[model samples]
Target: MSEKQEHASAYWKENLKYLIILLTIWFVVSFGCGILFREALNEIRLGGFKLGFWFAQQGSIYVFVILIFVYVRLMNKLDKKYGFDE
Candidate 1:
């Protein structure tokens, strides 16, 4: 294979690893903590909001938005690195 193709393949492999890790964290925090462990977290409160309630209502959504932006930024960087930027 050509050097360019090899580099692109390697870049994609690395990017996929990062994406998987980030997505796993997102899932765990939003689903695990917010839903599964919600009762355990209910004992804590912050700024008039119960921890579990906040996570279920607003925190997860906020995290999802941040994750979207993070994905966009990472993909943009990946595109540039792989000469796929438009």
Candidate 2:
């Protein structure tokens, strides 16, 4: 492949890697905490709310937002590194 093509491919691969990792975290927080480990997590309290309940109702959304920011920042850095940020 040409140099430009190689850079584009590498950028996409890195982007996908980050996307998969972030989504996995989302699934674990939303599904795993909300369902699979709810009972166990309920035994703990956070901000006076059950951990699992919080994760189900609020925490997951918060995490999703944070992940959005994380992705944006990472992509910006990646773009700069790949000479695509201009």
Candidate 3:
């Protein structure tokens, strides 16, 4: 492949890596904390609410937002690295 094509391919691969990692984190937090591990997490409390309940109702949303920001930052760095920032 040409150098430019190779760069594009690498950039796409890196982007996919970032997406997979972030989505997996989100899935674990939402599914594991909210359902699978709810009973275990319920033993803990945050601001008077059970941890698992909070994860189901609010924590997942918070995590998703945070992940959005994290993805933005990561993408910015990736863009710069790949000369795509322009």
| Full-model lDDT for every candidate | 0.87, 0.95, 0.98
Error of 3 at 7 (Å): 0.4
As a whole number from 0 to 100, the lDDT of residue 53 in candidate 1 is 85
lDDT score of model 2?
Answer: 0.95
Better structure of 1 and 2 per TM-score: 2
Clashing pairs in 2: none
Superior candidate under TM-score, 1 versus 3: 3
Instruction: State in Å the error of residue 10, model 3.
Output: 0.2
lDDT of 1: 0.87
Cα RMSD for candidate 1?
1.9
Tens digit per residue, CA lDDT, model 1, 1-86: 99988998898897998789879878988998799989988899978878998898888888888988988898898889788899
- All candidates' TM-scores? 0.79, 0.94, 0.97
lDDT of 3 by residue, 1-86 (tens): 99999999999999999999999999999999999999999999999999999999999999999999999999999999999897
Runs off by more than 4 Å, candidate 1: none
lDDT of 2 by residue, 1-86 (tens): 89889989999999999999999999999999988999999999999999999999998999999999999999999999998887
